[model samples]
Target: MDDYTWRIKMHQRRRRVRRERFAVLMLVVLSICGAIWYFGLYARTPEYAAKKLEQALEEKDIETFRKYAALELVLSDAYDDLTVDLFHNDTSLTPQAKSLFEKFYVLIKPQLVGATEDVICKRVSGGMWVMPEGGDMLKGRQLGIDYEEFLERSLLRSTRIKSLGEVTKENGSASIILEVLEENSHTPFTLELGMEKNDEGDWQVVSIKNYRTYLETVSPRIHQEVTEYVQATAGIVAKYNEILQSKQWDATYMSYSATGQLTKEQRTGLANYLENSVIPIVKKRQEELNQIPVPRGAMYLSNLRKESTDLSIRVWQHYVHGLRDDNIAEFNTAESLLKQMLATEQRIEDIIHRAAVSKAIPNMP
Candidate 1:
């Protein structure tokens, strides 16, 4: 072969190799670009956001949860829906009364919304509700509501997303329907979340589209649960009252206090009466009360009753020691404990009366 022909063939072979290398490089670049678009942009859709939100809630990933949820905006809209349902749809409320309530709600809406947001944030973060620094204690007392206790009873605290149903997107906005189950009631309900794409092209849940519907669906179950709780509590309270009334507890104590002083023989008799009679009865009642299962709604009352019973046991023990060892200070301590026990009893009665009169629970004694 001639030297010129060999050089021409070599040039053509090198040209072909260069072209193939360029094509392969371009293909690699396009593949990387496609992946960037899919994962970094297209993957951040409304449905993706909703799924992330569901996972965040399930895992209690507060930061990730907040990333997908516009908590303040969503809760604010939900509060409005709640008020509309409460005021507009109550058939028993006079139009004038409803107007008054609506006006009052508007005045307090900001504070209520802020408080609820705080509660939800704490709950999502797996933290207990603590009154914020510089909170208004006087106003809280006047409201006669325990926000923490209210949160404990609320459906929000127990809700779990069962499934993501459907997603509808329109003009940079979207709605996702979620099927949720509340652990407390074991009732499944649907929630529609309104979402919007921000300037960054990420979707965030901004509102609850059907909060009123959700409330209406859950309200009957809530009422039934409350009624059942009240009935069970009333039965327990009645049993406690019966135990207190069945014996002449006051008479037993009166015998010791009849005279300011007692002979040694009289003291011995009184000590025996307290130890063998009064103490056994009080201890038995306390044991029974301890064994009773307390419902969530009646926890405060149950605790108070338990405290009163404990004080009763202490009072009798002190009385017995005061008589046996002739210690006047023990007698004084018994008297103080008795006063505390009576005060606790009064508080329990006051709570029951308030609950009964408020029609919070019918047929409650």
Candidate 2:
């Protein structure tokens, strides 16, 4: 053990210390890398994305909702299912007609998709969903039924997540099963959502796997609701008709002739007859109709009836005033109002008849 041997031993000890330090540094680096992967990359899993989407929907955060939801793609997929159910359930349509409707749907799909997307965005942004006035335009008259309402009732309404099933992940893609209860129906249904990782590494919902099945499951409940609404509306309309019949309205209307040229005395008689008889009865009928409770589905019919009855009162009043003052302008106004009232009445009858023919109302006339 001389000076050279001691120096060699010191050098070996120094080397061993350096090696130990290097190993400790590597361990620290690996721990940091593992933490980053777990907290950052692993946290952004498919289930995490689905939870974010659920929270966004609950909060009505449209921007965040859009970040995770491929709305256009999902809706496009849903549209096919929707049309299939629509044409399938429509008993009035022949096979040829259904084929024509599918073609028409294809032609208008882009516009419909845009419009429906806008509606969903608006609903999410507004915090509450309500069909705006004249929104029935979304329900095409060519369909001859309320398809938009059916969609609204089935999908657009508020829903509560009942349970979330296992998330299955594939090659950069995944799926999750969600059980939800629709607020309006309180019926629970299952939805399988297809998700994929985007370029940004965030997972997004691409499509609904079981949308058609969901629609089929909910159709009977929705149809039952519609039937109940139609039946309730029919009862109210029947009561209105009964009132009209009891009043002997047709005979009363035909009793007076305002068309021919008349003496001043005859004009006075016509004015008195309308003011004393027609005006009061029309006003009373309007009041009675207004007092009746209108079902939500019958709002259109109720509004139309209200307009007609209001016009009927106004028409008789104008007729009485025209005869009393010999004012031609009042007579013209009365004629215009009469025409409008008649047209409104015709529309009411048409709707009732259509509902009856659809068998929405039993013994509807």
Candidate 3:
């Protein structure tokens, strides 16, 4: 081929290669955009959630409104110290009444996980998820700060959102400024609704900055209460753990009040362990194990289970007297043997018949 012809062919090939690379680049960009859209990242942004929340409240769409609210995060726990002091220790009640209250306080502390904020949210949501069935005493009472009041000040029907700033995003978290005005209020408060990317990689509202300004609108005492409530939520779970640890497990078990108070701390099977009377039986077995010459951390049935079945049985017979825990706590020996008997009834009957060749078949247990 001539030199000019060869140059022309080379130029055509280079142009073709450039076009192919550009096509691949465009395809990659489109794929990324599609994935972002598919994950609903656009729909789950803080700005989008805020706007939807505002509209939901305005339209009285309680169901939709709940999706945007952090019910778990804001709610008080019935088991909190403040609540125990308030409802469980009233001075004027009769003895029977006080006893009943005490029983209820003990019963529901762990059972009723969410408290005032959850209660109010449920009411607002028309019982989308109600409180603990026996939480009548907490009715109509806001534990510390009324989340409703916060909503009223921050996002109520009469509240006007003055501005929504561009979302400030960091790695997997974001915040956006909002200026809002409450009904008949001259001051427009500035706040920031913070957001986080959930496990599903969707943005969710996690915090509201300077939102405590709403608490300031109330009385000083009310402000203090709200502040305390917020602070309590931050550390209350750990506080509960501490309180539980502070309890003398040995005394509670020995006094036969562990179940009436709380289930055995280290229960494996849920049902067998939670019953009121059964915990004492389990504790008695544990007490027997405690009397043994075993070293630290070797008292419980869990450690026993890790040993060979023969070892477990030997240890139980040596340390524990009645083997009640072998049946109820560690594993249900009676139930399992009965099941095995039923499963091998034919074989068992045949063996019995052979054994009874010299005597009549024994009556079935």
Candidate 4:
């Protein structure tokens, strides 16, 4: 072979060797990344979950609480109950588990609904009043509630404490319990709380059982408030009626509560419904009333299925999804559909002067 030819062949061989080395190096890098993800990142699920639960509890995030709570965490209403269960109960709770539960409760201190914030935060923030911590007589005085003022506040809010207790520790397990005192309702309702421990020995609540709360009941004050709200709605209802009678689709559409409470899609749903179902039935009814106009009263009617709330919620969800995806058309479609449904069932009987007349308008039927 010629010298020049041999040199060329050697050069080609070196290039091929370098290429093979480059490929091998790339493979090694990828393998290292995969290992790091599988072993280092993926393996910390429990720790991450525990941290998240703790942070959420501290932040008083109810949504996070619901998400994190599984089926085993104990929750209760009263601090006394929790302490009794923790200290006196025959169960032996792991230190880690106890700490987690304590911290979680601290996080939700303010939102104990009717409970005084001082009771929850004071005990936890400062040392226990008479706890038997080893070698340390921890005498810490935090905020104490002025029972009278607290009671007054509770009365004004129309909510009061029901029950508060923790699960007696039994065989290394404990539960939290809170009995909610409802207003003008059940005497003592109970909420069962549960928590799970993480790798770091932190107890994170995973579930709530019998989570009864006083928020469901409306106080007499609230009832009065509702009455006032209805009275306020009278003007809006009148405008709604007039807009319907005139069959001014755009005007009716514009009258919808399309602000922050109702999304763009929700407003569109009203518009579409007005154009289709609402206009037809309303027009027919108006023509009939015109032919034989009754002086007794103006009877407005609308049909609302039991699932109105559910459908509205679903449309809102769709709207949210569309917003996330930046799909304006899809969002508007959902809104339009919802609006049409609302309009179909919307009717108003406007006895302009006799607004006080109470007439039973069939809604679902």
2 or 3, which is superior by lDDT?
A: 2
The sequence of per-residue lDDT tens digits that candidate 3 reaches over residues 21-83 is 999999999999988885557676766766766676566676667676554442322133323
Model 4 lDDT per residue over 104-168, tens place: 54654443432333333333334222222234211111223222222222222223445446444
Instruction: Output the number of the lDDT-best candidate.
Output: 2
Clashing residue pair totals per candidate (backbone < 3 A): 0, 0, 0, 34
Best prediction by TM-score: 1
Cα lDDT listed for each candidate:
0.71, 0.71, 0.45, 0.43
Candidates 1 and 3 compared: the better one by lDDT is 1
Candidate 4 local accuracy as lDDT? 0.43
- lDDT tens digits by residue: candidate 2, 5-120: 99999999999999999999999999999989876876578877887888887888999899888899988998888878765555576889989988988877776676677777
Give per-model TM-scores.
0.61, 0.60, 0.32, 0.25
Runs with alpha carbons beyond 4 Å of true place in candidate 3: 1-40, 75-135, 140-165, 184-186, 217-365
Q: RMSD for all candidates, in order, please.
A: 7.3, 8.9, 25.7, 25.3
The collision pairs in model 1 are none
Q: List candidate 2 segments past 4 Å from native.
A: 1-35, 38-40, 130-154, 158-165, 170-172, 232-235, 242-365
Candidate 3 whole-model C-alpha lDDT, 0 to 1: 0.45
